[model samples]
Target: MKVSTRPLWRKATLFKGVVVTLASLAALTVQASPAAADDVYGKPVGGAILVKYNELDRETGPLGCPTSIELDNPDGVGKRQEFAGGTIYWSAASNAHPVWGTIGGKWGALGYEGGKLGYPVDDERTDPDGAGKRQQFQGGTVYWHPTLSNGAHPVWGRIGELWASYGWEGGVFGYPTSDEGWEEPYQSMTQSFSSGGLTLFWSPGKNDETSWCKQECVGYSGAAGTDWFKETRVETYVGTDQVKVRAIPTRNGFNNARTDFHGAWNQVWSMAPYPKGINQVEHRSLYEQFACHAAWAEERLPGDWNTGPTWDLESWLPSIGMEKAIDPVEARKHKCNWT
Candidate 1:
C-alpha cells in the first residue's frame, strides 16, 4: 500500500484542481451570459428591487412585469423601479416597499417620493379594521376603501394625529375622504372624513375640532308646568353616528335649572351605539327607553300640571327610579339618562 501512496495523492490533487477550474468557468459563464441573468420582461433587474419583485411573486403577482430598470430616485437618496402594476422604492432608511393599485395612484398624485409623504416606509397592507388597505410613508399614511368612490386619500399632520386618537380607519371618523387643505377664513388646516360628512379643523394655538352633519332627531317629548317644566328629546341615526339629547324648557318654569341649561340644554353627548354592539333592535330599544324616560319625567314633575313642569334631566339620573324599565347597563353603566 505504501509503495502506491504517491500516485494516488497526485491524482486526488489533480481532480480537485479540475473541479476548481470548472467552477470558475461556470461562474464566469453566469456573469457573462445575459440568458443566465435576472431579467423581468426582457429588462435586467437586480439588487433590492429584484428581491422585492420576487417576494411579490414576480410577473405572476400583483406587480406584473418590470417596465423599467432600477434607477436612482429624484431625491438621490434612494432607488426605484417601475412595473406594469406598480413601483418598488428602495432607500437605506426604508429598505424596499411596493405601492400599487389605488394607493399607488394616490401617492403618485401627491408627487411620489418628492411629496410631503416622502419615501414609503411600508408596503400596502390590509388595514387592521378589515375595511380597507393602508400604506405608511415617511411623512404620512394613505388609505383606500372599496366603498369610497374617491379612491385612496392621504392623512397626516395634526389631523392625522387626531384621527389616530379616535382609532384610525376603525374609529368614529372612519377613513379620510379628502386630503388636508387650508381654510382661508380661519387660517386652519382641515380634512374631511366619513364620506365628507365630517370635517376636522386645526388652527394655530388651538386643538383639533370636528363638525359633522346634524343627526336626525329620532325621538321627541315635551313636558309643561304652570311655573316650571322640562321636555327631553333624543336625536340620532344609524351607522357610526352621534347620539344627542336636547332638553327644551320654558324660561319662567326652569329658572333654577343648571346654568349650563340656559333656555334649553345645548350640550351634545356622543356614544358609539346602544347596548355596546351594532344591533338595530337593541339600538331602537335604547331610543325608546330614552323617550319613555322623558315621558316618565314629564309626568312625575310637580306643578299645577297645566301642560307640565320642565325639569333638568341630568339631575334625575340617580333618582329616576326607572332602572327596572330600562336595562341596568344602559341606565347605569352608560348613564343614558343624561349622556
Candidate 2:
C-alpha cells in the first residue's frame, strides 16, 4: 500500500552547516506506522524485511499430517542446532489419543516447553486450531502467555527470537512472520489419513486451524511422486492496498522493486539491510502480528507511520484529508508528534 513515514524537511541555512538538532533527529527516529510482515513474497521496509508468502500449507484433517524439515540458523547466534531444527507432524486431534512420535521431536519439545503460554499437560483434549486453555497442535499444545514464545512452537525458539530473526525476509530455515500478531504462520502440510490412525497439525495460532476439506496431505515421498517440477500458473495480487504491483521497483527508489507477492529473503535483504535496517534490526514487534520494526538509513525514504517532524504519521492516513492539522487536540494530548 502507499504507506508513508515521516519525511525529513531539511533546509540549508547560509550561516550554518546542516543545523539539525539531536531532538529533531531523535524525533524522526520514532516509528509512526503499523508493523510490517516478513512474508516470503513481499518487499522490505527501510530497516527490516517484509516477509510474505501466499500460504504455507493448508490445514487438512488429522490424517493430513505434514513433516518438519530442520533449519540451520545462518546468523550462528541462536541456541543449539538440535533444538533449532524445525519439524512437522500431525498434531493431536481435538480429542485425546496415544502418543505416537518421539517426545524430543521439534513439535514435542515446544508442546511441553512449560511457560505462561505453555499448553497444560493436564488437559486431555485439543481443538483443531490449538486454541482453548489446553489445546494441542502438531508441534505441541497451546497455552496463553503474554509473550509469543509461551505457546507451542511451530518451530523451536523463544517467542521473541522467532519473531525478530525471521522478519520480512526468508527465515534461516522456516516461514517468515505475518501481519496477524502472534498469529503468524510457519507452514502447513497436507496429507491423507485413515480413521484407525491419529493425525497431527501445526499452526502459529489456535484460531488458525483449518480442515483440509478433503485436500490430500502427502508425505515428502508423496509430494515427490507428483509432478512438482511441472509448471503451474496461478493468478494472484501483489503489493498492498495502496501500492500497485505494476509500479513496484519504482524508478526513483520510491516504491521501487515493490512486489505485492511473497518475496525471497535474499531479495528482501537487498531492499532493507539487516541490523540497523528493516530486514535485520531487531526490535519489539510494533503490533500483535509481531513483525520486526523498521530502521531506515539516512539515504532512504520513510513510511507514513514515521514519527519524524516533517511527516506526522498519524495525520498521513491516506483516507484523511492531507491538509488536516497533524497535531490535533486529541493527538497532542496523547503526545503524538510528527517527529
Q: Top model by lDDT, which number?
A: 1
**Collision count for each candidate, in order:** 14, 69
Error of 1 at 148 (Å): 3.6
How would you encode candidate 2's per-residue C-alpha lDDT over 1-339 as one tens digit per residue? Answer: 986564444323522444456556766666344453221123222111111111213223221222322223233321111111222212122222222232223234443333222322222343233432233443333333122222323322233232234331123212211111221221432211111121122222223335211222211101111111111111111111111000112222222212221232223223212322222111211110111111110224554322221111111122222122222443343332222
Q: Which regions of candidate 1 deviate over 4 angstroms?
A: 1-37, 206-267, 270-339
Alpha-carbon RMSD of each model = 12.7, 35.2
lDDT of 2 at 296: 19
